[model samples]
Target: MTTPPLSLRARRAIVMTAAVLCPLVAGAQTIAKPAIGPERPFTAPARVERTLSNGLRVVAVRYPTVPKVSVVVTMQSGLAVDPVEKAGLAQFVADAVQEGTASRDSRVIRREIFAMGASLTAFAGQDTSSFTMRGLADTLPAMMSLVADVVRNPTFPQQEVDLLKANTAQALQAQLASPQFVANRVYRQTLFGPHPYGRVGAAPETVANIDRASIVEYHKTYYRPNNAFVVVTGDVTPDAAFAAAEKAFGTWARGTVPPPPTAALPALTGRKLVFVQRPNSVQSSISVGNFTIRRSDPRWAVMNVANQIYGGAFDSRLVRNIREDKGYTYSPQSTFQAMGQAGLYRAVADVRNDVTGATLKEIYGEIDRFREGGPAEAELVNAKTYARGLFVIQNATQNGLSATLNTIYSFGLPNDYPETFQKNVSSLSAEAVKTAAQMLLGSQDSVIVVVGDYTKVKDQLVGFTNITFVDISGKPITPPQ
Candidate 1:
C-alpha cells in the first residue's frame, strides 16, 4: 500500500512538532533525587594510659556505653617497609600468619577465632605494621591470646606458603586484568620513581618466588617488643589491660630496632603526559599529582588544607567542577598520600571516554590556579573546619583510638601528636594555608597519566606538547606514535 509522499513543508512541520514534544516527554520522566540526611560526627571514649617495665605502652579507653572492644598491637612497620626485591613482603607475611602455628593448626586457629567470634589479622610495613583483634569485650582476652600467638610465633608452614604463593599469583593476575589497577600501579611507579613507595603492593615475580624462609626472616628482623607499640582500648581498666597484655605477650623478647637502609628521594624528573591504551575502555581513568611532603614533614598541615579545598570532599573544587557542573562523572577526588618518608599529592577521576582530554585540561588548569594564586579565604576556613571536624570524629571511640595508635606508630608521631594537632588546627590561618598551597601545588612540576581507549582519545590529546604512550606494564607502548 503506497501513500502519497509528503512535501518538504509537511516534513518540516513534522520535525518541528517532534522537537516541541521531546522536551515535554523528558521533563515528565525526570524526578529529583531525595536529599540525604546530614552527616553525624563520631566521638571516642575517654583514654587512660600506662607503661610497663618492658617498655610496653598500654592505653585503655573507657566506653561503658558500647559492648564491643577493639584492640591493636601496632609496630612501626607496614607495606612501606617491604624489602626492595620483595616489594609486597609485608602484605604477604601479614596474610600468611594464620596459615598455621607451632601448636595450633591453621584450622584450629580459624575455628577458635570463629567460636569466640573474634576477628584477627596482621599487616606489616616499612615504618609500622600491626596485628588487630576485635570482638565483644568479654571475649577480648581470648582474641588477645590468639593474636599474641600469631604475632609471637607465626609458623608460616611450608604448605601455607605454597598455598599463599598460589593465591597471591592468582590475586595478582586478577588485579592485572583491571584497568584501574593497571592505571594506578603505573602512576605509583612513575610518581614514586625509584622510591620504595613507587612499587606495587606485590611484585608479581617476587610473590611467585617467595617462600617460608623469606617470611620468617622478615618477621624476625622487625617483629620485636621494643620496636613495637601495643594499644588496647575497651571496657577494661588500665591495670587489667596491662595485666592482660602481659599475660599474653610479656614474654616477647625485646630486640634492637633494625637499622633500615637509607632512602634517597629522586627529584621529580619532569612534567609529562602519558596514556595506557586499553583496547575497549568505555571511560578514562586520569591521575594528576606530584610528590608531596613526608608524613612527618611540617608542611603536612598546609598540604592537608590545600588538598581539601582542591578535592578533599564531595563539595571540593574538583567534584564541584567535574560532577556538579559538567556532569562528567559522579565525583572526582584528589588526595595526599605520603607515608613514613614521603607522600605524593594526587588527583584521580574517571571521566567518560569522550571527555578525557577536556577533563585533564581542566585538572591542569585547577592545579595551575593553585600555584599562581592559591585558594581564597573561604576555602581555607572551610578546609580547617572540615579537618577539625574530622579529627574529633577520628578520635571518638575504641576503634578511633586504635586508629590513632596506628597512625602514631606508622608515622612515628610524637607523644604530643593529638595535643599539638588540636592547637595547630585551631590556630590555622588563611594566610598559612595559602602559603602551604602555593608551595605544594606546583602544576609545572606535576605528572599526568590517562588510561583509556587511546584510539578515540588520541586526536583530542594532541594539544599536549608532551605525551608518552605506555602499555599496561608501564613500559613505553610505542616510540611516541
Candidate 2:
C-alpha cells in the first residue's frame, strides 16, 4: 500500500532529523586518526638588526605571509622604576603618553591613527613599557611616525592626567570589591615585601598623587632612543623598515636612565597561611606560590615542562585530581612567571568554601608525590610534546612571531632562543624536570593566600603553620578577642 503524503511540519521535522543524523552516521564510520608526525625543526626568521646613529636599536623581519606590519617600541622603563612616593607613576605615564603629543592633540592623534586603519596601544608592566602599532603594510611609515611621535613627545596634558587619575580611581574601587583581586594584591605584598612587584597594582592614593610634571619627567628620563628598541615584522624589506624608523625616530636625543634600585627580596622561611575575610562568600580564592628563577635561568625549560605535568594544563595532576576526580574545582592551574630579576611559581584555584582546605591538601599532596617520584616516562613525553606543539603554534603567525621576538628582546634571550628552546625541551629528561620541581615548588617555602569567609574555613586551615590574619590590603589585623 502507498503511504500518505507527510504534512509540511512533519516533513520539516524529518528533514531536520536527517540533517543531524547524517553527520552522526558519517562520523560513526571509522575515520583514520592522523598520525602524529615528528616535530619540524624551527628556523628563525632572517632579521636585520641595526642601530641608528642616535643609538635606537631596530630589528626588522620581512615576513611576506600577510599584507600587514606590526611595530613594537619597548622602553626599558616600567612600574619598577616608579618613584617610591608615586607608586603608579609609570602606569600613569603610560596612560598619558597616548593622550596627546606636542604636535597633535589627543583627538587629532586618534583620528590619524584610525584614518590609517591602524591600532595603537601603550602599556607598562613590571620590567618594560611598550607602545605597539599594527596596520596595513602600505601604512607602515605613517604608523611608525605616529608611534614615534607619541613615545617621544607626550605633553602629558594636565586635563588628560586628571581624567586618567579619576578613571583609574573608579576602576580601583571596582576591583577592590572582588575577593580575587584582594587575594592577588595581598599575595604579592606578602611574597615580595617592599619590592616594587609586591605592589602588584596602583593604590588609589598613588593614582591621585600622579601629576603631569611627574609624568613628563618620567618620559624624558626613560623614553630615550638609547633605552628603547623597535621590532618590526611583516611585508617590509629590512632596508625600507630601517629607513622609516630613522626618519621617524633618529632625531630623538639620547639620555641616561639610571636603573631603578633593587630591594632585597624577603626570604620565605616556612609555609605560611594568610587569610583575608570575605563575608558570606561561597567560593574561596586561593594562591600558593614562591619566588623562583628569572627568565634567563637555564632551568626554565625544564621547569616549564614539569609545571605542565604538575598543574599547567587540563590533564595536569592538580586539575585531574581536584576537578575531574573530586569535583572540587572546574580548573586548577600553575604558572611560572619569569621576569628580569626574579620570578614566581604560582598554583591558583577557586573552589567552594567548604572544600578550601581539602583542595589545598590535595594540591600539596600532588606536589609531594611529583617531588618524590617525578613524572612518569609517559607523562614526561606528553609534556614535552605539548611544549613543543605550543612553541610551533605560537610563532606561526606574523603577530605571534613579533610577540615572540619582543619577549626574546625583553628577557635578553639568546639570538638563537627559539632553536635553543626546541632543543632543550626535546632533550629534557624526566629527572631534570623533577629537579626543577623540587627546587622551585617546595611547600616549606611557599605562601598560601586564601580569601573567603574565615569562619567557614578556619578550622580546616588549623593544620597549617604561621597562619596570619590580614585585611584585603595586606595589613595585619587582630582576631576578635
Candidate 3:
C-alpha cells in the first residue's frame, strides 16, 4: 500500500528543510581549486652549431634528460620542390631511402637498429624531408652512420620500388574511403588551386609514373650536403657530437641545387564551397579556413595567441559555442600551419548530418564574433598560459626537442626562436591578439569543404552558395537529384 500525499504545510516544511541542508551539503563538497602560480622563467637548452667542411650544418644540444639521444637529418627539399608532373616524388624518395644501402640491406639494417634499441624513420613534408633515429646514447655514432647510409646510398632497388608502388596504390585506395582525407584533399585544392601545396600525396597515377631512375635522379638533385642539416639532442658534448657527425657524413659532396619552385597562389575571394559526395555517409566532415602568413613572420606570436583563444584550445570560443553550448558536435578545433613559403588557418569539425548547416553557421558566427569583440582579459591570460605551457611540454623530451630544432632550421626561423618564445607570447597585449584576430579570422575570404552524402546534406547547405560538386578523386561531377 502507498502512503497518502502530505498536506501543504508538511510539504512546505520538508522543502524548506531540504533547501537549507542543500546549501550546507554543497558547501561541504565545494573544494576550491589550487590557484595557478606565476609562470617560472624557461631557458631553452644551449645549442652548439658547426658547419662541416662539406657544408653540412650540425646542431648539437645537451638535453641529457636520459641515457638516450635523438638524431635527425633533414633535407630542405620536400614536396615544395617536386616537379610539376611528378607530385609526391620527394615523399616517394623518402620512403625508398631506407629499403637498402650500398653495403646493408633492409633486413640487416633493421637487425642492427633493433639490437641497439633504436628506431629509424623517414618522412617528407611540404618543405623538408627527414630521417630520424632515437636510440641509446652509446649508439649515437652508429645511428648517425646508419642514417647517413640510408640517405646517401639507397640504390632504389627495382623490386622494392615495385612493391612500394603496389602498397601505395592500395593505401591510397584505403585513404580515399576516409571522408576526412577526402575533405582535406579537396580543401587544399580549392584554397591553393594549382599550387604545389594543393597536392596531398602520391596519387595512384603518380605512383605508377615513379621508377628507379626517376628516384635516383631526384635524390641526386636534392640530397646534397649543402642542402641539408643535422640536429642531435641527448646526453652528449658538442665536440663529441660534431666529431660523430663528421665521421658519419663528412665525405658527402656538396652539389649545386636549383631554387625551390615558387608558384604564385591563386587569388581567393568570397566564400567558396566545395563538396565531395560520399554517398551514405552518416556524418559531415567540414574544413574551412584561409591562407595566412609565412613561418618566419613576426606576427606569429600574436596569431598563435588569437588562434588559441578562438578555437585552437579545448576551452576556446568555437568549442564552447558549438560543442559545449549548442551540442551540435564534438571535438571541433582550429589550427594554424606555417611553412617556409606560406601559412594556413583552418577550423575543422565532424558533425552529424542533421546539424551540418547549423554547425557551419555556429563556426562562422563564433569566428565573426571573436574577431569583432576580441577575447576577454581572462581569456587572454588563460590562452597565454596554455601556449607557454605547451611549448615547454613539447620541448621537454629528446624527440620533441630534436623536432623543434628541425622546424627551426628547416623553416629558416631564427636560431633563438625557442629561447624567446615564452617571452614573446607572454608580452602580447589583448589589443594585439584582437588585431591579429581581425586580420586573420574573417569568413569572407575562406574556403569551405564538406565530405558527406549530397543527398543527405544538400538541404542543410541551402544557405551556402558557390557550391561545386566533385567525386572522391576530386574530379568534377554532377550531383544526384
Top TM-score prediction, candidate number: 2
TM-score-best of 1 and 2? 2
Per-residue CA lDDT of model 2 for 272-366, tens digit only, reads 88888777889999999899888888888898888899999788999899999999988789988888888888899999989999999998999
Residue-pair clashes per candidate: 18, 0, 0
lDDT of 2 at 235: 91
- Per-residue lDDT tens digits of candidate 1, residues 365-392? 8777776676687776677778877887
The sequence of per-residue lDDT tens digits that candidate 3 reaches over residues 1-481 is 9999999999999999999999999998887888988776667899999999999999999999999999999999998787766778898999998898989998888999999999988889988899999999988889889999999898888888899889989999999998888888788888888888887678767887878888999999999999999999999888889989999999999999998888888898999999888889999999989998888899988998999998899999989998999887888999898888888888999999999999999889988888888889999989999999998889889999898899889888887899899989989998899899987785788899999888997898888779999989998999656
Among all windows of ten consecutive residues in candidate 3, which has the lowest summed lDDT?
A: 199-208
The whole-model lDDT of each prediction reads 0.77, 0.87, 0.89
Candidate 1 shows a clash count of 18
- List clashing residue pairs in candidate 2: none
Residue 7 Cα positional deviation in candidate 3, in Å, after optimal superposition: 43
Q: Using lDDT, give the best candidate's number.
A: 3
- Alpha-carbon runs more than 4 Å astray in model 3: 1-30
Candidate 1: C-alpha lDDT: 0.77
